[model samples]
Target: MYDFYKTISKTKIDIVYLGETVCSKRKLLRRDDWLEIAEQLKQSGKEVVLSSMALIEANSELAAVKTLCSNTDFSIEANDMSAVQLLKNKPFITGPSVNIYNPSSLKMLAKLGLKRWVLPIELSKEALSDMQSEKPKGVETEVLVYGRLPLAYSARCFTARSHNLPKDNCQLRCLDDPDGLLLSTQEEQKFLVLNGIQTQSAKTSNLIMDLHELINLNVDVLRISPPSKHTEKIIELFHKTLHKAYSASEANRALQKLMPAGGYCNGYWHGTNGIDWQETTEEILCQLS
Candidate 1:
């Protein structure tokens, strides 16, 4: 984990999200541990944002959210309303899990001292264009352009359910699958992944293909969600693609080699089936628009 942070810190990526965003039960890193990691990343000249959980069921979880919100050192990515309540009137970024869909929600959040926000994964390009036009002054936007899309969050632990064990006594089994446990269909096709309470797409969502549109839209940040492997190279490829140092087609080919098994999906960005991979081109973009 330390090595991963060190490698990412050296990359040209502007912001790095650390800490758990899905499950509060994850204990591989305690508060002090995350603080130490944040210190290391800051030392490497990387801006770090501690992420809050998507759900706050237990009082202990709410207390943890408050602690992250009250931190004086680094900024935070608030994922729940509880975090937002604690962070009101203070500069902070909202996470993708915050259910911000329309311009009204964006305007409301902006009024609450929101400096930036991650576009919800399911929002289409056209939808984003509308939101961008109506976006509040001084508010920036980040899009989830890579890695498996986080589909949903639930209170039940699907990983523990797989073993016929209850969520409370799951024995921290999710740690075994550092990335996530792959879920397959009856036909043996990989469909989704179960990471504790978070369900993610089985295929990595690659939007290096949409670099042109994102840049055209003036997106403030292009977030490359971390996968199980090849993250450093993936970051490099995306960086090159964004700068036109490499073409989208070339980057896509290279990405295929780097992530051979994890396939790619860009449907949500195209307003199609979330799992579908729609090849976008000048002609196609014209037709869609």
Candidate 2:
């Protein structure tokens, strides 16, 4: 984990969200370890935000969120409402899981100390623009430009169930599939991914082709969720594209090679099916015009 963070610190990415945002059972790193890593990343000139789990199902989980919210050094990314309540008026960012779908929700959160909010994965570009226009004075908008979309979360441990084991006694099977265990249809078409309690889109959500639109919408941050492999290269690709070192098409082509077998999707951004990929040629032309 230290080696991974070391590699990330060298990358062009600005913010690094570190924590166990999924199941609490995945105890490879404790709170102290996360804080230590956050400190290291901060020293390395990166803004580190500790992320809380999306589902606070237990007292221990709520306690963890409270502890993270209490940290004074770096900010916290509240993934659940419990975290938000704990972090009230403390100036924090909300992760994609918090469901800030409309301007009213955004306004309310801003009043409660939301400095930035990540657009929910399923929200369209149009929705973002509308919210961006009305978002409170100091609130920044972030978009998930790349990575597998975290579609939903469940209390049940699907990864453990896949192994026919109970949630408590199940071996840490999620560790076996780092990226996520892909689920496919009977026709062999790739579908959703089962990562313990989180359900993610099978296809990686790549929006390199929509960078212009994102910029036009005044997106403050473009998040690239780290995949299991080629993360550094992905960051480099985004940085280059953002700086005009690489054209969007060129970056898109390069990104395709780095992705796994399921291919890519940007349908949610187009206001369509979350698993479908929509071509952005016309949209890019419209934006340029």
Candidate 3:
């Protein structure tokens, strides 16, 4: 992924999140490897945030969290409350998996030295507006503006079960499914993707269509979770949308071709179903015209 780091460092995205934020069992990169990649990203003039593992179940995992927290050089993305406690008094960012649903919780985290907070993907735009109304100063808001939505995490490895292998003995087999192991419904419709212990939505949440609303909400950062393919292209598309170089409909058209087979969804943004797609007024007008 160092090659990916080099590619994104040249993109228009301001902040880059490094480090593994999901299952800790997948040890593709060590702590030093992450720091070295962090240096490379920082050298390319990008703000780097070290992301922590979301589910820390073992004592060794806690030890890893301690190591990441003590780095002191780069800011960290607190994925769990334990991480938050470790990050107290330090300027750190909160990942979307962190249950920061209410304004009271937001205020409490702000007091604990949170520099920024990623909106929980399930929270609607209206909910974010209400929360942002009472958000503390100096705490920036980041939206999961692109990529597959991380729906859930579990201690059990579903991918291992697929191979009929025990979780412990299952070789790092998930690496074979780079994007994720696609889980289809009984109806054969593409449902969710299993990435180790994390379950992600099959539909990519493309919010280039909602850039206006985000800007109006005063969202500080727009986060695009990396997919296996077209990572740099997606970043460039977001850059174009952010700069008003492409209208939402035009960008949506261009983006549709780039999406994975399951396609895009923004139903959560509209406060509806998570997996459904809701079209914009422009797209509707285009359809009629």
Error of 1 at 24 (Å): 1.5
lDDT of 1 by residue, 119-169 (tens): 899889998999999999999999999888999988899999998899989
TM-score of each: 0.95, 0.97, 0.96
Q: How accurate is candidate 3 locally (lDDT)?
A: 0.89
Give the residue spans of candidate 3 off by over 4 A. Answer: 283-289
Which pairs of residues collide in model 2?
Answer: none
User: How good is model 1 by TM-score?
Assistant: 0.95
Q: Give all candidates' CA lDDT scores.
A: 0.88, 0.90, 0.89
- Model 2: per-residue Cα lDDT over 154-258, one tens digit each: 989899999999999879989999988889999999998999999988899999999988998999999988888999999999999899998888898899888
By lDDT, the best candidate is: 2
Better of 2 and 3 by lDDT: 2
- Model 3, 1-289: lDDT tens digits are 8788888888887888888887787888888898999998898898989999999989999999998888888989999888999999989899998999999999998998998999998999999999889999999999998999999999899999899989998798999999999999999899999998899999999888788889888999999998988988888888887887877778888888898968899999989998988878785544543
